[model samples]
Every structure is written in C-alpha cells, then in structure tokens.
Target: MTARTFQATNPATGQPLAPAFPVTTPQEMEALVAAARGAARAFAASTPTQRADFLNAAAAAIEARADAFVEAAMAEAGLPEPRLRGEVGRTANQLRLFAGVAADGSWVDARIDHADPARKPPKPDVRSLRVPLGPVAVFGASNFPLAFSVAGGDTASALAAGCPVVVKAHPAHPATSKLAAEAIRAAAQQCGLPAGVFGIVYEDGHELGVQLVQHPDIHAVGFTGSRAGGLALVAAAQAREVPIPVYAEMSSVNPSVFTAAALEANGAALAKGLAASISGSGGQLCTQPGLLFVPVGEAGDAFLNDVAAKLDATPACTLLTGGILNAFQKGAAGHLKAAGVQPLTQGAKPDSGAQPQLLSVPIAQFTPELADEVFGPLSVAVRYDRLEEVTPLLAGLEGQLTATLHATDAELDGLADLLHVMGTRAGRLVLNGFPTGVEVGHAMVHGGPFPATSDGGASTSVGSRAITRFARLRAYQDFPDRALPPELQEANPYGIWRLVDGERTR
Candidate 1:
C-alpha cells in the first residue's frame, strides 16, 4: 500500500497550507539514493566551470521565483516578510558564492610533491586534490525554511563540491521545501547535469531517516535540529555496516557573558541588547542566548528589571509547530518553578505562540541541568559574584555554536580566565554583540563540539569551508602527468594557486 500524504499547517493561524506531500515508500527512497549514486560519478567528474554554472542556475531559479518561495516559507514558518526575504537573499547569495568557489577552483586544495629519484631511498612523485565523497543526505531544519532547507548551505556546498544531494524535507514546511527542491531540480536539468544530481524525499518519520542513513550509497549526512534528533541520526549513521560522518548542528544555548565593567558601563543597554537577540524569529535560533551571565550587585538587579520591561513589551513569537509551542510552554513553566530560579517576566501562557520569559538564577544554584537550552524567545540571567566562578560556570557548558561577551575596554584585561574558558566551549565567540545573526562569509563558523555538532572539529556547515565536508583528498602516486586531475597538473590549467613541494605556486 502507498504511504499517507501530509499537509502543512500555518503556525500563526493554525491553518493548513495547500498541496499535500506523499511519504515515499522504503523502496522509493532506495530508488532515490540509487539514482544519486548513479549520477555521482558524472557529477563528481564535471569540470569546475560546469559545476559553477550549475550553482548559478539554481540561484537564478530561486531568485526568479522569489515571491512564491517567500510566500510558502512565510505561510508555513510564520516568519515576517523581511526575515524570509532576507533568508532568500542569503540563500541565493551563498549559492552564488559556491558558484564562485567552483569557478575559482581553489576548493580542490591541491598539492604536488615532486619525485626525488636520486635519493638513498627513492621518493615517488605524488599529487593530490580534494574529490567529492559521493552522495550525501541532508536534513532540512524547521527554523530556517529557506536558508537551512532544501537549497540551503548543505545542498549548495555539497553540490558545489560535486556530490549529489538527497534532502529530507522537514515536515513543518513541506511546501517551502518542495518549492526550493523544484528550483534545484530545474537548475540541475538546465545545466545538463545528470539525473538525481539533486533529490528530496518527503516524510519526516524516523524510519525514513533510518532508511536513508542505512543506505549503502549515502556517504555522509548533514542535519540541523534538536539534540535528541541529531543524536538519533548520529546513532543511525554509526549503526550502518560502514559508518558515515553525520555533520549535525544540534543544541546550543549560546551563553552571553556581561563583564563587570560592561554591566557597570551600560547595564540598561546590555539588557536591551540581550532582548534584541531573543526577540528575533521568536527566539527559535540555534544561537539564541539561552543563558546570560551577570555580575552580582545593583547593576545586575537593574539589568534584570530592564530585561523584565523589555520582555513585557516584546510580542509573542509564533513557533513553527504546535508541538514546539507546547514544549516551549512546558519548559518555561518548569524552569520558572525550579528552585533558585526567580521568575522576572512571564509573558503569557502558551497557546498559538510563545510569550517571552526571563528568569534569574544565582551561581550557587546554577548546574548543568539549568543551562539546557529552552529553544524559544526566553532568556535566563545567571548571577555570579566572583570572577573566579565565571570559568567554572562556562566549563560546565555543553558544546555551543556561540558564546558572546559584552565587555568594555576597561574589562578586557581582567577577562583572561573567561576568555580561555569560552574558547573551548563554542565555535564562534562574539564580543559586544549578539549571536543571532550568522554571516555567510569565509570567516564564519556555524559548528561546535559534541552536542553543538556531531563532529565540529572536522567540518563546518556554513560558508565556503562547508564544501570540504562533502569532499576528501585524493592522492595520485607515480601517475602520468596527464592522468593527474586538472587542479594538480603540472601546467596548473585552472591558474589557481596551490602548494607545490611545501611552497605555494600558481
């Protein structure tokens, strides 16, 4: 029997969106993976110029249909037009960036170590460059329907790296995913790429994820979601007969520390800054500052008051799903009632959306249990009296995407311990700013250790470095000059810079 089809619901109005999506059968999913494997060899062998053109085509397709894409995303995600439009722009820009990456030809990371024929022990000529790691399975995220969905960074980077992609469309925004998926498919066709260069499977069931991970053709996986979900995928990938790396962006509270000088210099402004971070997109951001560090004193007390006022004025955030809304409400209530956590502001009971909540907890009572991310527009203020306590508190933190510091010039010299501690805990460290906005540039790091990501040290899921995850270094030893990949050839056909015998050459 055919599997059931599902419809999407608008989080803002509890209304259903049109055009249901069917859950593909196990056999159908196998076909999708098989098709991707079939296309992988050709896609991986496609020249940098051809791959670059493919990305440009996809970006143009999304831009051409920006309205339809934005409309579907907004309706399903309940995000403001400005946010969705900005996301579309980011998505398009990143695609274009990867197109440039393919065009520039530097992502290959080529190196050549010439042979030393007259040595006591002869050294063989060796040349190497990054090669695509076959087909990859990507899981779209709920919070970012456009940028982290069908044609998001994972898909864009994988395609740029010459790996075929098979995305698991997040159920919360199936229509949006479908729209993005169609754009990608059309672009692939327009670029004369082989079939299954890009594909997406419907159905958010655990079994579907399991089937995809277990599939022998899938070389790797990319995911963005809750710790539980990411962990589940990691486990599934490990259980496979031949394990594959799962680059999963999971939980992060994105702790923000307010230095004593910062708290004293502009406590009110710092409070407002904290509000701004949690205010966006109903605070569903993975980088949301779930915990804020404040020094004990009148400044901390006043800052708490400022936070209460800020939250009271902030509107309710429409969550992506009813289940998320329910979970947010329960988490808020349970934490507020927890001992030593003093409630500062409780916006409203959970219903259609989440009301912002701010609570205060002293350092004496702060524990690993209390630092868990609330996953909504709620922020917690953890009070610390002594500077020594800061490192201990941060040391207890799980792997994080970002850890922010609101510091003044006067405080910088005195923050060594805090600095040392934070560097180990998060991927991106921010100063006098919020972590909500992640730039799509080469310098950005959107991954962290352990719970923040499955294997943060190995790869990133954003920016140009993201392409490296879907590729591996290929070494050609004692091979003919003509047999070497174009990137590693003697002539440097692409004219891009590479390391030759430990020295950079073009």
Candidate 2:
C-alpha cells in the first residue's frame, strides 16, 4: 500500500507471482526516509534495554513465522526448500545475535582519557562515546533473499547500532521482502516504537535506488550485489556534496589453491569436494570457490578431469531471476571463449533455462583479467607447473572476501609463507574446507578490500561487524555530571562495556 508494490515473477516459468506496484516517487521516497530519520533520532536516544527489547521482539516474530517466510522466499527466488529453510534460520539467528549485542551495548566502546593534573603541566580530560549515524539505505541482494533482504543482516545490524533502515527490495524477491517488512513493522509497533523505523521500497528499476543513495538525508549506504551495480551506487554516494560512506560487497573470485602434495595424497576425493562446491547454490554465493589452482601433474590432470565430468553430469536448477540467468549465460560463454581458456564441462543443453558449466586453463594463460567472477555455476581450473610459478600469480590476486587453501599437514607446513600472505590478501582464509558454508559468529569477517568491499577490514554484509557501519564517535568534553548522557555517565546505569582511561573494563 506504500506508493510502490513491485511484482515478483518466476524466473523459470515466466509467470507473474504477484501484481506489480508503482515505483516510489522521489517525494514519497523522501517522506519515507524522513519518517525513518525521525524514528532514528528517537531510537538512538532510547535506552539500550529498550533497543534490545525491540530487536528480540523482531527476531522472535520472524522465527515464529519462519515457515511462511521460507515458502514465500522460495516461491519468488526459485531456491529449493532446504536452502530457504536454512537461510531463514540464519536470518533469525542474525537478528538474535544483534539483539544480544544491542542489549550488552559493548559495541559502543566508551572511553575516558583523564588529564595529568598531578604533573607540573595541567592537561584537559577527554571522554568519548559512539553514537548512531542517522538513517541508512540498504539494497538487498538477489542470491540470499532472506539473509540479505528485508529482515537481513544490514537491517539487523543498523537497528542494533540504533540507526533506522530504508530497504530497497530486490526485484527478484519482492513478495518475500514485503512479507518480511510487514513482520518487522509489526514488531516495531508491538515494542511501542515509532512507525517507519524500517521502511521498504519496491522498485524494479535502478533509477529509484540511485535516488535513494543520492538522497542528502541518507547518512550511509549498505549494499550486496554485482560489481557493476554496487560500484554505480558507490559512485553516486561519493558524488554527493557531503559524501556518505557506501559499504558495498561487489565481486569476489574465492580462489581455492590445491597443493600438489594434497592432490597426490587424495586427488579423487578432493575432486569430488570441488565438484560439489562449484555446483552448490548453483554457484551463486559470494564465497563460492570459482577458481581452482592445481599443480600440473598426472594426478592433478586426473583430478580436474573427474571434476569436469561430474559438473557436466549435475543437473542445473533455475537461477534467481531471468536477468541473472541471461547474465550467467553471456558471462559463461564469453569466459569460455576467452584466449587460453578451455571448456572442462559443458552442461547438457536442457529444454529449459538450465546453464551450468565449468572451464579451465593453464596458470600462464589465466591472467588477472580472467580472474574476474562470472557469477554463476561456472568454475575455472588453473594448472600450475611448479610451486615457484604459483607464488607470483597468487600474489597478483585482488582482494577477496575469502581465499581457500586446500592442504594436509605436510602441505600446510610447506606452504606456511603462502598462508601468511593469503591471510593479509583476503578477509577470510579457509584451510582445507569449502568456502561456501559461511558461519554467522563473532569471529567472521564476511567482507574484504577494494572491489570485494569499499572499506578494508569492515564487513558490509555479514556477522556482528556489520553493526560498526551504523555508528560514529561522539566526545563529551568537560560537562557537568547531570549534563552527561546516560550512556557515558559515571554512575554506569546501562552497565555495558567501557574503556576507562585507556583500559577496557565492564
């Protein structure tokens, strides 16, 4: 009933799942953001207990209706029941994590630096605390509808940090977004919070998203999508007069390096694992292992052959949307025909739109340009002749969300230097495990540098780190005890984490 109610169409069947709603007009978008801004002002000023209560209520509400949420998301996105169900659990867990974090209030990290009055010279005291950064614009991703859409990590973390959200629903899953938005709105109302604490905008085109990010009132932007799309929004935000920080997770070729020793030890088993990873989620995850670097030898060749054959045999499922399917086909074909690239596995040309394939080339042939992600169920195998030949090429790898090193104890010990360098190059370093299973926990850093994300060491899309994006620091200089804010008061009413004179204490 908002100005826009975008329709969701099935990618495989080409049928309308729901009626389309009008795109939000510029004025309507502004009004929605204004409401969120007002809500943010009050929400940020609320006690940590109140904020935590609201977040817990929202999580409980979502969990209670988990089945309906999963079904709606599956209907719109074409994901199978199992994946959707797990993603729904992830979504609720994220909300619950943020709830615990907000209640604890330790993320703010209040600090107080006292003056050296005892010394010959008198110095001024300094006290600081973190404050919410007004309203945020969140652009949902197509791949993980529940975990990245309306009731996703972006909204959860922003709310935990006491910032309001305006979610630009992904066109691929509008119905699911709408349903999730309703649940969040209901929770806000139940908590007696202001209306429009979280706003949902339904728009199929990019124009509205551009407007939302460029809006002067929007303090920051959170996005997860393709490199092209995420970059456009980042550019728009930077172009603003008062530039806002755009935390965008663009692209990553989560390259998996298989040591010669590991291949020699268990080539066949490793090949099967690689096949499953490349084909999982139709190879749609940002952390999907797209590239496999294997040492050139009889065992390596045999392993790659097995992987290629298995990929060809696997049946392709429907992609998230028609646009994604088209892009996948175009990118797969282009990458396959590129210089030095060779087809490893080409899925059977099915009667429907199921295009799943794998391609490979030699290390010398795989250039930095070829390392670019194709965004589908496509994998590239790079054959290395020697360990020395692998290092230089590995060093040239761009910053990635994750880089996996497949090795045994002997192989890992031999590749210690490589592991050390890889830790710096990627936000996450996986050892002998598929990179697809991203666990939501405190230690997880689901973002990376450069094209993987705009900010280095800051997670834009996943885990508790996402909450940091919604806050700014505030200092209280020489104020009366009564005038000091409750969060930064000497009495410690909130009883959260704090740093007193350069020391962390409860």
The candidate scoring highest on TM-score is 1
Worst 10 residues of 2 by lDDT: 346-355
Query: Model 2, residue 59: displacement in angstroms?
Result: 1.4
TM-score of each: 0.97, 0.95
Estimate the TM-score for candidate 1.
0.97
lDDT for each candidate structure: 0.87, 0.82
lDDT of 1 at 7: 88
lDDT per residue as tens, model 2, 1-506: 45645578887688888667677787778899999977877898888878888888888888788888877877788888898889888888999889888888878878877778787777667678888999999998999898888888888999999988999999888878877888898889999999868998888889989989988889999888998998899899989999999888889888888877888888888888888888788888898887778888888888888988888778876888888888777777667667888876756222224555767788877877678887878878888888767666767888888888877886566787787767767888988888888888877889887788877646646787779898999898877667877767787788977888778877
Query: How many clashing residue pairs are found in candidate 1?
Result: 0
Give the Cα error of residue 157 in candidate 1, in Å.
0.7
Flag regions of model 1 displaced more than 4 Å: 1-3, 348-353
lDDT of 1 by residue, 410-461 (tens): 7788888888889999999999988999999887889987789999645788
> For residue 12, what is the lDDT in candidate 1?
89
